[model samples]
Target: MPSPDRSSDAVTPFHLNVPEEELDDLRDRLSRTRWPERETVSGWKQGVPLDRARALVAYWEDGYDWRRCEAALNGIGQFTTTIDGLNLHFLHRRSPEPDALPIVITHGWPGSVVEFMKVIGPLTDPVAHGGKAEDAFHVVCPSLPGYGFSQRPKEGWPVPRIASAWIALMKRLGYARFVAQGGDWGSAVTTAIGASGDPAVAGIHLNMLVVRPTAEDLADATDQEKASLESLQRYMQDGNGYSQQQATRPQTLGYGLVDSPVGQAMWIYEKFREWSDCGGEPENALSRDEMLDDIMLYWLTGTGASSGRLYWESFRAFGSDKVMVPTGYSMFPKEIFRASRRWAERQYPNIIHWNELERGGHFAAFEQPELFVEEVRTAFRTLRTS
Candidate 1:
């Protein structure tokens, strides 16, 4: 059991026990899915393939086990706490090593605390995972507001506000000082945390960086920089429809997503195929169980609308502020927007570590857990002060 809530701003233990009725409702919904006709052309250019969607839903209804996912979450010690009037859910695992550094890992859209499940044990208990005691860390993985189990905000909650909430959350957990790490929107929140100039934030490490290059920075771009820019352009042209919808009119898109299980699954499954290191099929990068486990976070929470609202609230707000703390960046090859060190350094002046990895993509931790863990351990090894 988790420690009791100590004060008004107390942290409370949380458990997952979805009622059997909810599971039955999900099966019923999946059984009665109203899928559209097959795409005019073959392949994923049109979205999740019809046959693929049916196959996944078939497994989800019959073979997938929500209780197993619940057990895995409970095994890690889940907890919740009120911050600025919103209840936030998090996984808190303290290291056996007394002097381990404290770190907070945040997840982004189409993802939840599920992304960190594989990496948590290794981070908090390094010896058992083939690492020195010095490599251990006390890891905290928080569900973003409106994502997973966290309470959705009634009004707008931009990245800056989310960053403030994160800092407060760490302080509430008795971590006076800690490092922040993330990918996707997690990267945006971590950047804001570092930019807030909070002394409690020792440093930040990112697998995905949100950087907007200036005319000056772009004029003398190197070959790699040019390639990065081209990738961004391509994404803006072909891959930005979902972002545009989420940013401009999430409520309009939310009806279908919230009402249909297949709607929610394909919405996220498409990203898993597009953003992951998977060549064509998402299953190549993540197992069916892993993918559905994440999808369930959204489906169970009924947060399809709220989560999409994050983009509506802060899509254009990224790269508006510069992060000044000691920073580390791990650039995965297939990330939607890859920023070269030159582009990123212009925004993060004190960048201490920068590496271009051979594989992985937007969902770095979910796709390549071991590589992600190694990158995190190596990135923060130099930032630890105690």
Candidate 2:
């Protein structure tokens, strides 16, 4: 396919045709990975264990098929359009129900639109999935500007900027009034969209709610708030090295990630395990094939550095004013930072729905798609009536 023309608002049809050489090179690299010594202690204290790494790498070379994922994306109706001088690739699947609400879903680092595959069909066509017509959504999942199939940025593209692009994107797609939803970095952008008070947006929803609790709120914290605080502290201390590196020197770290298929797999695989409530057993959360498919997006696109640059561009500056629009939040127990309703209310004053789920984690849609869909449909149900 010709490279996407970047000068116009044309939404061009797109297809994936991974050359045979790319897969051949990936297999060769996976086969030749220089083995690392086993951890000094045990059970993921140092990082991904040597044995686990070997198992995944072995399967990545022999068991995973990238063609299946390519076909799935194409079947979902992928397209590319220029927004803010960048070409964005997105999956757009309209519901059979014409009145279905249009919703844009965003993905975060180490994740691509591939993460939402399990929930898209169920969401876009609720009747086929045993849901009422009123619950249907015209789903749009974008590969974040510097991630997945979207084009890389030449300069800073922060959260507010991305949120603006998404607003324009939805309007360009004929959605005059729609809701927004996201998690991870997507949560930041979605929140910014609501904060923009974009007249076209009806409201917003987030599985991961990021909020800063003030001293006054902390003084009157509940048990749930205390637990949330503990989780946040742990992440600040132990789980944020990757964020720091990405925010500071992504290009320096990209060489190994882009060069070694095994390196890229483990970097993301570790997060999938640690964040998805499957602490010691990653395959318990996602099959090696599923994990490898997400890895291939990073590997084939060679976007390891470009994707991380979003962190460098917006990490410290990723916050929003109080969102006055009707908001909905689902707090997953295993998420890196589980904000209490009161804490979230500081940023989102008009919360219409709040549910503290007993299961799932950061990759909510990928790990627990059924629950994720339920939360989304229920959260937006009230907004639809208005």
lDDT of each: 0.90, 0.89
**Candidate 2, residue 15: lDDT:** 85
lDDT of 1: 0.90
Residue pairs that clash (backbone atoms under 3 angstroms), model 1: none
Model 1 CA deviation exceeding 4 Å by range:
1-7
CA RMSD per model (angstroms): 1.9, 1.1
Winning candidate number (lDDT): 1
Model 1 CA lDDT for position 277: 90
TM-score for each candidate, following the candidate numbering: 0.97, 0.98
Please tell me which predicted candidate would have the highest TM-score against the true structure. 2
